[model samples]
Target: MDGIVVFGAGGRAGRAVTAEALRRGYGVTAVVRDPERYAELAAEGVSVVRGDVTDAGSVREVAGGAVGAVHAVSPFSGPEQGFASLDPDFFVKAADALLAGLASAGVRRLIAVGLFADLLGANGRPVMDDPAAFPPEIRPFALAHTAGLRRLREAGEGAVDWLMLTPGGGLEPDAPRTGRHRFGGERVPEGAPGLSYAELAVAVLDEIGTPSRHRTRVSVFVPREARVRRT
Candidate 1:
């Protein structure tokens, strides 16, 4: 059977995607910076490769023979990688490196994890730009993620076949999966923001099998009932 390379397979979203792909009987290569960190996945019959997407050559080598790749790499680390590296532009840098690596590896199809950039405030600007958009601590992350979306658009268009899966709500673990979701682009959708990372993975893997949103930024909206229970 063919395989898929999932960069940052250690992350929550990446792990979900890996497991989903494996459940469907597709060979999965879990790529991470440190192989030891993802030893558990290796034991699960996955081909774990200690590779960094930041290093194009290494990714190129690791991605060989894979049918597709997922850009789940994120550089924000409060203590593990140091908080100083959490800049919006740094997100762009990592994405660029991943793009170069994918291109060199001959992988044409890519489904990336992106943030909600289409959320506009009264000022006609992204909610991330508003000081009150979110708590100060998390604002930087939102900004960086939004910037990541722009970087994906600016870089991925025409160069690579890519889909930026922007979930409308927080990546909630408890959110119910109805196998249902709505898709859109640019402008953010209105409703409660809560998308199960597990369900989000389904969207990613589904697109990989039969991609229709090539080189575009798309958002998924789960039903409001899926996010909150009735009293």
Candidate 2:
């Protein structure tokens, strides 16, 4: 009851965050659409529950008595899953629900994972806008993610202290956790090598324990030299 509540706990990022939270000795409440699907996630200190990230009522119900919350939900998982069923306002709804629900539940911190495609490239344009940098077909998904980020900004110092950690490059699931990452501003860092989901989880948990950023989005990546030396 006194640990973090993680939405989309079945996803790779969500699972990594959950694992990291548990490793840090924090009890976890893993919220997923279908609790049965993630039964394996239920452990001695972890509880897998059914909840909706876009529904304020559901979020409030599941996130009650939590230290903080994580929004790791993704409507589009991969390129194989086309954008036909993707909702442009999915993240907007999520932002609204999370801000309201977390506030109502007395949880102050909200950390949302972000898409790398929306990060500005060296050309001063979104990576998604550059076909050479990102897949044009995935632009819609990036737009939705960016819209959610915009909603969070528009909230403007509301009850929930939120931070969006946008990956500068790729998120390698199979990579090792070096426990090292670099943070950047709006634009992607020069020669930014990506970090692992585990490393991302480290950043997420670090923020929850001792928040360094508030109501802003930052690019998180591993420097090319750091990646080479650490790996």
Candidate 3:
């Protein structure tokens, strides 16, 4: 897209996504809770706006005048690293504000950053369908993310063109970007490989430039065999 807004621009994945969007020559405005936290982004010539993710008015202000909005707002902290205590309703609320803001401003395309737990597994089952599959600590967040995707999918039909990028389990700071990734249907392959945040950013930018991949959710990953086995 020629012009786009990115929420959570200060976040880990958000930074990469914004950088990629800029690399593709798309004008970008990065929404952040504290603009100071992302000084580097500001120095990079990106338009940075201060706004709270939980506030509709604030989110709306930044969402205006952009052709595409990427919902990359994530509030997770490192130590806790779990979603059980996280408010599930906040996701829905954010969606409401985002959609409302888009509707009022005439912006129609939405690209969201979602968790892989909502994706279907090898047996045609959602990743959350097999709760026992992952560590107990992370299940709650996974389920909540799945719910968020459902809400986005439902709201997208009216006028917004939405696509959710469900990142694999092993996202990391150093994930590689070969600029090539595989797109699967509802069910992702077994052993769910990992993808670098940089690569995920590239994928999102690709979708932004190519509108045909709309109203869809796809997983980001690298094959297991290509992964380096660590000790």
Candidate 4:
């Protein structure tokens, strides 16, 4: 694998992944619908391209010839309590575009940032299927993520190498990247379940080159029970 392409490259997770990849000396292409908004990525020697996850033609043009691509595009914001609101079908369409684009571009690998909603909970069912898994505010995005995972499975699970990385159901905002976190298949990482954006980025980049979680789900979480009150 040579360079990497990032869809939704302007968002928090996407930006972190792009910066980390550059730091590790891998060429990167940041695909964004608005190039001006993410001009900083271009300034950092990354290849900035105008693209949208809903447009297959544009996606194919930008993501072609890359080693892999990360679908980290998140645009909508929920109520002040959480940033998790979007049209129900947005991610499904995004998944469709990614599938068409990667197939056309001949890119064989895709790593998507998934929600904990799709990860199996303690009851051995995806959180999305379990009622009361999240508050009403986050339900829209959670359902969108669930739909996106289904689309990915239908389109690329066997056709192209794909992986889903979930952040243990949620994360702490504005936390330091710490370069510290832990990951497991589908269970929570002991306690507090939160993983920093920076550490999650590390796990994303690490998985791209090494590919330990292909065609499966990997949950990166905070280690040692962050914020646990000692007895």
Best TM-score goes to which candidate? 2
Which pairs of residues clash in candidate 3, taking residues 3 or more apart in a chain or in different chains?
Answer: 175-196
Q: Which candidate number maximizes lDDT? A: 2
Off by over 4 Å in 2: 228-231
Per-residue CA lDDT of model 3 for 60-172, tens digit only, reads 78877787888888766542665555887767777777777777767888888887767777667777667565555666666666777777777756677888877766677
- Model 4 scores worst on lDDT over the 10 consecutive residues at 222-231
lDDT of 2 by residue, 25-100 (tens): 8889999988888767885457999999999999999999999899999989989999899999999999999999
Write down the TM-score for model 4.
0.85
**Reference-based TM-score, model 3:** 0.87
Model 2 whole-model lDDT (C-alpha atoms): 0.91
The digit string of per-residue lDDT tens for model 1 on 89-205 reads 766666777678878878878888876644664567775666665445656677777776677778735555878888765778666655676676555566635578778888888
Model 2 residue 48 lDDT? Answer: 90
The per-residue C-alpha lDDT of model 1 at residue 152 equals: 74
Model 3 stretches with alpha carbons more than 4 Å out: 79-85, 129-132, 224-231
Q: Candidates' lDDT values, in order? A: 0.76, 0.91, 0.75, 0.77
lDDT of 2 at 224: 72
Tens digit of per-residue lDDT, candidate 4, span 131-209 = 7775665667777788888887776445568888889847655666665666788765555267666767878888888
Query: Model 4, which residues run further than 4 Å from truth?
Result: 80-85, 123-133, 173-180, 225-231
